[model samples]
Target chain A: MVEITIISGKGGTGKTSLTAAFAHLASNHVICDLDVDAPDLHLILKPENEYLEEFFSGHEAIIDQNLCSSCGECLERCKYNAIKETPEGLMVDLLACEGCKVCVHFCPVGAIEFPMRRCGQWYLSKTRFGPLVHAQLFPGEENSGLLVSLLRKQARGMAEKENYNLILSDGAPGIGCPVISSLSGTDLAVAVTEPTPSGSHDLERVVNLCEHFKIPVGVIINKFDINLDQVKKIENFCQDHGLSLVGKLPYDHAFTEAMVQAKTITEYQSGDLAEEIGRIWARIEALAQLKKAA
Target chain B: MIIALASGKGGTGKTTVCASLVRIWDKPVQAVDLDVEEPNLALYLKPELSGRLISEMEIPVSDQEKCTACGACSEICQFKAITVLGEYLLTFPEMCHGCGGCLAVCPEGALSLGARELGEVLWGQAGEIDFLMGRLRVGEAMSPPLMRDVKKRLDSSRDVIIDAPPGTSCPAINAVKDADVIVLVTEPTPFGFYDLKLAREAFTPIGKPMGVVMNRTGFGDAGAYDYCRATGLPILLEIPYDRRVAEKYSQGEVIADALPEFRGRFIELAARIRELAAGDLKEVSNG
Candidate 1:
C-alpha cells in the first residue's frame, strides 16, 4: 500500500484543504488526519464516528497535600519546574509536567502520585469519501507524536484489512514530533508550501527532515502567483536539491470558499483549480508507482 | 506589557501583525519570535544579530563501567527511554524527555546527565525593537524548553510582543503564558473559526485578557466574527484582504513599512491592546 502524507512546515499553509481535496479525488484509500492537536481536516471532511477511543499516554504528578510534608524535594528535582510553590501549597502544573516520574521518585514523603494522563482521544470514522482515522490531543497536552503514530498504525491496519491501496494523511505543521511521526515510513512526503520567505525557509527545513529519514519528497508551491520572484527562487532550490516540483497552484479564493462550505475544491467547483489539483494528484500517483516498482 | 500574538491555525498573520506593531510602537519594543520551529519575525524586521546563545536540554547518559544490569533505572523511566538489554543498557536520547528520572533512580551511580543541543536563541535589534528569536535544531522534537529559554530574555522594562507558534498545544501555551494581552490572529473561514475556538479554549485557563485581529477580512465567511461577538472577544483590528498586503508580506516587508499609511493603523492597534490590558476598556468580559 502507498501512504502519502501532506505536510507544511509552517501553519495555515493549506495542508488540510489539500488533504480534503485529495480525499475527494483518490479512491480505495483511508484518510487519516495525524494532526492530533487542533485537527482541521475533520472540520472540512465532517467525518461521522464509527468508534472513539480515549488516548492515554505518559503520566502526570499529583501532590497529595494531606499526606505531604513540604520537603520541596520534588520541586528541586523536577526538570520541568512542574512542581510550583503556590500560595495554597505545593502544586503541580499538569501541562508543564513531562511525566518523567522524577518527582514521584524523588519525593521525600511519598506525597506525589504519578498517574497515567488521559491526553486525548482518537476516532475511527466514515466520511463520504472514505474511512478516516483522526485524533484530538487535549489542549496543553503533550505526546502528540505518540497519538499521531497510533492513528497512522490504525490507518495502516484498516487499509490492510480492507485491501485498500492507498493511505492519504493530513499532517500537522512544524518540524516537530507530530510531523516526524507523520513523515516517517510514508511512501512520499508532499511538502506543500507558498511563495514567501518563511514558506521557503520552513519548506526547506521540513524537506531536510524528510531527507533525514531518507524519504522521497516532492514540492507543490501553493499560491505561486503571489510572488513570481520567490517562485523562481523556490523552483531553483527544488532543482538544486533534486526535489520534484509537483505542481504550482495559483492564489485562488475557491479553496477558502470550499472550506467555508465544508466541501473540497473538486466538490465545490470544477475549474482550473480542481484541474490543477487533479494534475498534482496524477504526479503524486506516478511517483508512488515509480517507487513501488523500484 | 507583554503582548502575545498567536493563532490556532498557521499563516494567519501573527508575524505580520507583530512586525507591524513593533514598527509603529515608536518605542524600544522587544519582538520575540517564540515560534522556534519557524522563526519568521526576523525576516520582516531585518534584525542584525548582536549575540547568540545555544539552547540545550539535559539528557541522561549511562556510564557502562559503573553500571550494573539491575533494571531500576529503566523501571523508573516513564518515557521508556532506557532499556536494560541483558548485559547492555540502551538509552534512546531522542525519546528521552530530559527529566533525569533514570539518573535519580540509579543506585550504582552509573547515570550522568549530558546536554543535547536542542536549538539556539538569537538576540538582535531592528530599528528600536530588540529582536529575539528561537530557532530549533532541524530534527529536534521538543520545543517547550527552548521556548522557556527565549522567554527568559523578556525585557519587561520595554513593551514586548511575542509571536507564538501555531496550534493550541503545550508549546503554544508556553509562548502565551504570563502575557498581559493575547491577540489571536485569524482569517474569516471555517478552519479559522474552528481552530480559533480551540485556541481560545487553550488560553482561557491562563486568565489573561485577549482579543482578536481579523485578518483577510474580505475572504471566506464571517464565522470568525460571529465567534468573537458571541464569545465576547473584542475585535482589536480588522485587516482587509488587500493585494498590496499580500505582496508586501511575500516580499518580507511589514505592512507598516511597505505602506506608510498602515503605521497609523498598527499604532492604533498597539494602543487598543494596551487599553484592553490596562482594563480601561473592559468591554469584553474575558475568561
Candidate 2:
C-alpha cells in the first residue's frame, strides 16, 4: 500500500482542510490524523468510534503524601523542575515531567510511586467516508510524538487487515519529533504551503528534511491567487528541488465555510474542490504504481 | 518589562510583530529570538553576530574499548533516545534529553561525556536594542537545551521582547515558558480556533497571564475574539489586513518602517504589556 502524508511548512495553511478533502476523494484509503499534539481533522470528519484502546505512553511521578514525606529531598534531585511542593502536597506537572523518575528514585521515605500516565487516548473509528484512526492528548500533557506513532501503527495494521490500498496521514507542522515519526516508512509526502515569504522559507526547511530521508515529495500551493509574484517564486522553488507542484486551489470562503459546518470541502461541494483533489490523488496513485512496477 | 510575541499556530506573524515592536520602541529594548529550531529571526533583523558562537552542550558517548555489554544507558534514559543491543550501543541523538542519568550509573566509567553541536546562540545589537537569536543546527533534535541557554541572557532590566517559535510544542514551550507576559498572535479562521485551544493549554500550566492579538481582523467572525471574550482575556490589538503591511513584509521591511504610524502603535503595545506584565510578574514570583 502507498502511504501519503500531508504536511504544511507551518500550521493554519489549510493542511487539515486539504486532508479532509483528500479523505473524501480517496475512497479506498484509511485516514489517519498524525497531528496528535493538536489534532483538528476530527473536527471535520466527526468519527464514530468503533473501537477504543487505552495506550500507555510513559511513566509519571506521584507523591504519596501519607507516608510523611516533607523531607524536601526529592526537590533537590530533580533537574527538570517537574516536582514542586504545593499547599495540597508535592505536585508534579505532567507536561513538565519527562518521566525521568529522579524524584521517585531519590525519595528517601519511599513516598513516591511511578506509574503510567494515560496522557492520551487512541481510537479506531468510522466516518462518513471510511475507517479513520485518530487520538487526543490531554491538555498540557507531553508525549504527543508517542501518540502519533501509536495511531499510525494502528492505521497501518487496519489497512493491511482490510486490504486497503492507501493510508492518508495528516502530519503536524515543523520538523519536530512528531513530524519525524510521521515521515518514517511513508511512501510519499505532500507538503502543503502558502505563497508568502515565511511560507516559502519554511517550505524549503520541510523539503530539506524530507530530502535527508530521501522520501519522494510533492507540493500544493494553497491560495495561489493571493500573491501572483510569490506563486512564481514557489513554482521556481519546486522546480529547483525536483518536487511536483500538483494542485493550486484559489482563495475561497467555501473552504472555511465547510470547516464551520464540520464538513470536508469535497463533501460540501464535489464540483471544483473535489475535482482538484481527485486530480492530486490520481497523480499519487500513478506515481505509486510506477514505483511498484520499477 | 518583558513582552513575548507568540502564536498558537505556526506562521502567523510572531517574528514580524517582534521585529516591528523593537523597531518603534524609544528606550533600549532587548530582543530574544527564542525559536531554536528553524529560527528565522536573523533573516529579518540582519544583525552582525558572527563571532558569538557557543557550543556548551555535552551528553554521554560510549568508549567501546572499556564498554561492557550492559544496558545501563538505555535503561536510565527518560527520553527513549538510547537503545542497547548487547555490544551495540545505538544512540539517537535527537531524542536524547541530556539528563546525565546514564553517565552517573555507568560502573565502568566507559560512558564519558561528549559534546554535540546542537545549535548556535548569537548575540549582537540592533539599533538601540540588544539582539539575541538562536539558530538550531539544521538537524539537531534537542532544542530546549539551546533554548535554556538563550534564556540565560535575558536582560530583565530592559523591555525584553521575545520572538517565540510557532505552535504549542516543546519548542514553543522553550520559547515562551519564562516570559512575564505572553501575547498569542492569531488570524481569524477555523484553524486559528483549533490551535488557539492548544496555545491556551500550553500557558495555563506555566501560569502566565495572556492576551490575544487578532491579525487580519475581518477575515472571519474572528473566532479568536470570541474565545477571548468567553475566557475574559482582553484583545490587545486588531491589525487589519492591508496590502501595505503585506508589501512591506515581502520586501523584508519591518512594519514600523513600512508605516510610520505603526511605530507609535507598537510603542503603545509595549507600554500596555509593561503595565500588565509588571503587575503579574510580581505575583508569579510570590505564588
Candidate 3:
C-alpha cells in the first residue's frame, strides 16, 4: 500500500482541508489524522467512531499522602520541580511533571506511586470516505509522538486487513516530534503551504526534514494568490531544490465557507478550488505510483 | 510581566501580533520566540543576533567495560531510551527525555551523562527590544528542552512577550506555563473556534489569566466571539481581514511598520495586556 501524508510546517495552511479533499477524491484509502493534539479532519470527514481504545503511555508520579513521611527526599531528588510543597501538603504538579518517575524511584517511604498516564484516546471511525483512524491527546499531555505512531500503525493495519491500497494521513503542524512521527516511512510527503513569508520559511524546514528522512516531497501552494511575489519565490525554491511543484490553490473564501458547513471543498461545491484539488490529488497519485481512481 | 502569544491552530498570526506588540510597546520589552521548531518570529522581528549558543540535552552514555547488563538502567527508563539486549547495551539519545533516571538507577555506575545537540539559542537586539529565540536541530524530536533553554534568558525586570508555538500540547504549554498572562490569537472560523476551545482547556489549568486577539475578523463565523463570551474570556483586540496587511506580512514586514494606522491598535493591546497581567498579580497578592 502507498501511504501519502499531507503536512504543513506552519499550521492552518489548509493541511486538514486539503487532506479531507484528497480523502474525498482518493479511492480505497484509509484516512488517518495524525494531528492528535488538535485534530480538525473530523470536522469535515464527519467520522462516526466505530471502535474506541484508551491510550496509556509513560508514567506520572503520584504521591500517596497516607504513605508519606514528609521527609522531603522526593522533593529534593525531583529534577522537574514538579513536587511542590503546598499548603495542604506535598503535591505533584501534573503540568510540570515530565513523567520521568524520578520521584517514584527515589522515594524513601514509597509514597510516590508511578502509574501509567492515560494520555488520550484513539478511535477507528467510519467516515463517508472510508474507515478513518484518529486520536486525541488530552490537553496538557505529552507523548504526542507515541500517540501519532500508534494511530499510523492502526491505519496501516486497517489498510492491510481491508485491502486498501492507499493510506492518506493529515499530519500535525511544526517539524516537531509528532510531525516527525507522521512523516517517517510515508511514501510521499505532500507539504501544503501558503505564499506568506512564514509559510515559505516553515516550508523550507519541512522540506529539509523530508530530505533528511529521504522521503519524496510534493509542494502545494495554498492561497497562492495572497502574495504573488512570495508565490514566485516559493516556486523558485521548489525548482532550485528539485522538489515536485504539484499545484497552486488560490485564495478563496470557499475553503472556510465549506469548513463552516462541515464539508470538504469537493463536497461543498465543484468549483475551481475543487477541480484544482482533484488535479493535485492526481499528480500526487502519479508521484506515489498509485493507480489513479477510475 | 510576561505575555505569551499562542493559538491552538497555526498561522493565526501569533508571530505577527507578537512582533507588532514589541514594536509599539513603550518599554524595552524582551521578545522571546519559544517556538523552537520552525521559529518564524525572527523573520518578522529581524533581530541582529549578537550571541549564539548550542543547546544540548543530557543522555546516558554507558561504559561498556564497566557495564553489567543487569537491565537496571533500562528498566528504570520511562522512554525506553536505553535497552539491554543479551550482553550488549544500546542507547537511543533521540528517544531520551533526559530524565537522568537511568544514570541514577545504574547499579554498576556504568552510565554517565552525554550531551546531544538539541538546537541553538540565539539572542540579540531588535531595535530597543531584546530578542531571543531557539532553533531546534532538524530531525530532532525534543523541543520543550530547547524552548526552556530560550526562556532561561527571559529578563524579568523588563516586559516580556513570548511567541509560543501552535497547538495545545506540551510544547505550547511549556512556552506559556511561566507567563503572567497568555494572549490567544485566532481567526473567526469554525476550525479556529474549535481549536480555541481546546487551547483554553489546555491552558486553563495553568492558572494564568488568558485573553483572545481575534485576527482576520469580518469573515467566517462568530463562533470565536461566542466562545469567548461564554467562557468569559475577554477579547483584547480584533484585527479586521485586510489584503494589504496580509500582503505586507507575506513580505516579512511588521504590521505596525507596514501600516502605521495599526500602531494605535497595538499600543492599546500592549496596555490591555499589562492591565490584565497586573490585575492577576494583584488578585494573587490580595488572596
Cα lDDT tens digits for candidate 1, B12-96 = 9898998898888867789999999989889889999999999988888889999988999888887778989999999998778
Query: Which candidate model has the greater DockQ, 1 or 3?
Result: 1
lDDT by candidate, in order shown = 0.88, 0.77, 0.89
lDDT of 3 by residue, B161-272 (tens): 9999888988899999998899999989889998999999999988998988999888888888888888888888889888888788888999998999998989988877
Q: Give the TM-score of candidate 1.
A: 0.97
List, residue by residue over A148-250, the lDDT tens digit for candidate 1.
Answer: 8999999999999999999999987899988998888899989899999899999999989998999988899998888999999999999998999999998
Candidate 2: give the clashing pairs. Answer: none
lDDT of 3 at A91: 93
Count of residue pairs whose backbone atoms collide, per candidate: 2, 0, 0
TM-score of each: 0.97, 0.89, 0.96
The predicted structure with the larger TM-score, 1 or 3, is 1
List runs of model 1 lying over 4 Å from the truth: B282-287
- For model 2, how does the per-residue alpha-carbon lDDT over B1-287 read when each residue is reduced to its tens digit? 66778887676677778888887777778888887665666667777774467755666787777778588767778777667786777766656666667776677887877777777778987667788977766555567777777887888788788988776766777677777799988777677776776788777777877877777655555566677777766666667777567656655678888788777767767666676676542211100
